[model samples]
Target: MKTANNRLDIAIKKLYTAFHDDCLHPECCKQCAVGNILDHSDAWKHFSDDHGSTKLNYIGHVNETFGKRFNGYTPSELLLIEVTFLKACGYQLPLHFKNNKPENPTNKDNLFKGLQAVIELLCELDKSPNVMDYTKLFDNLRISKKSLVLK
Candidate 1:
């Protein structure tokens, strides 16, 4: 059995990948497998703002100044890449909203609750090393000088 914290942590981990994975590697790099893995180069060409900053983008930039990486990849292709990468990294993504009912019939309260829980958990994780792969992730993606506010 899992506690609220455990459940929330698990949910946040998935949300972390959902929100990031794309921006960590921009499309400006060399194209091919490496390029594709880094960022969907095609997506950036089609989506980046006037300046290189990836703000006004989609597919969940969250904290990363990012937009969606279109890169001429079909939705299915993107899905395959993300899924494969996650699997290779030993992550199994969340199911797309399984059979859970909301206490209120029409308000979408349950879904919103889950989203809120996930966002809160992710925010906590951004600061604390509470996530599962914190060491590996922090090492690979160096923290920015301004971003790390050590107490």
Candidate 2:
């Protein structure tokens, strides 16, 4: 069971990845060189209110200073890659969400579910003051990488 502190730590790490890893210009080693993770979402205010910096909802490092950029991957390709990466990382993902749900949900349901779970958890944490302890909520939910089956 993850204590509130541990869950907070986990959330911070995920938020860091989501915020810092995306480079519209995949070749933008300059931004990577900066190695800074900035908050790109409104969740930071909520986190500050709770006196916890781990309640991350939507985080990303978007730099408008750079002009047009080229990332070798198309939008669809980026989504696929993100889905695969998250799955390989052991996060549950959702497959259904009304109009935007995937047709082949089973193919990467876990990945979607995992991503959704993270966002949802962050949202819940943002909204609820007592949601600091997420042990019961995330214990059985998050999978260990060791349990992943390489197929």
Candidate 3:
């Protein structure tokens, strides 16, 4: 079975490959001349000591003390958020099916449509407190939430 990092690498590679018209590139590389994936999330900023001044020291300070916004989402959770955002925006995620071939290759029109839908959905959710609670990464996306989801 593929590990989480492997799955993430695959997804990122596809995103990088497709946009650069490297459909037949056959592999992903750091010097792809288009895009590269890296960890830059709140969870990473709040946890890793490598971030130096930016690190929130979330474990020793935030969650261990007041349980502030530093919830320290796992790598898998981050991957889920990334993949979901891409899908919600109509990007074709490079997921392999057990039987049937995957459908819905992303195109410019579909991407625009998906983005429009996402914006409308967020706007609608903005008026409703209950709906926004399920989404934890909204702050990262610069979305404003008036209150926490109590459920």
Candidate 4:
């Protein structure tokens, strides 16, 4: 069984590859955030009829009931993660073309924003700090007292 951290690492790598390759998309199951995390598997689509819907379908509920985790994320968590990604990418929920979507879905900036949100969610799921967060590097507490005392 893979630990949450292991899953997070794998997810980050996959997302990085997808983003760099311009393969990430809000509409494509194999290219969406959850899809990439699941290694380009469309199996996650069975969790919900709508792409960005948080409400799971029968299969999702069944899997949730069985405590089945795909790459260390529950079915509901997967839906939430996808929804978060879609929202961050400026997409309207459920991902219908009629709904609002980024002007350029494949734009690197939009995909990066989506990936950032997804990574943060993944970190939350793993109960770990967001590896992408660099603000902590500027924390005053981490500075040495000696460094504060100028010669």
User: Against the hidden reference, what TM-scores do the models get?
Assistant: 0.21, 0.20, 0.25, 0.88
Query: lDDT by residue for model 1 over 89-128, one digit each (tens)?
Result: 3223421234332334213333233334334333353354
Best by lDDT: 4
1-151 per-residue lDDT for model 2 (tens digits): 2334543445445444643444311112121101111223222222112211122222211211222112322222223333333443343442223324323423334333444444444434335333335676666555554356442
lDDT of each: 0.34, 0.32, 0.34, 0.87
Give the winner by TM-score. 4
- Looking at model 1, residue 41 earns an lDDT score of 42
Candidate 4, which segments miss by more than 4 Å at Cα? 1-4, 140-149
- Residue range 106-147, candidate 3, lDDT tens digits: 444544443333333333323322222435666655434343
Candidate 3 overall lDDT versus native: 0.34
CA lDDT, candidate 3, residue 66: 60
Model 1: lowest-lDDT 10 consecutive positions = 25-34
Error of 2 at 128 (Å): 48
Error of 1 at 142 (Å): 43
TM-score of the candidate numbered 3? Answer: 0.25
Off by over 4 Å in 3: 1-106, 128-151
Clashes per candidate, residues 3 or more apart or on different chains: 5, 10, 0, 0
lDDT of 2 at 120: 46
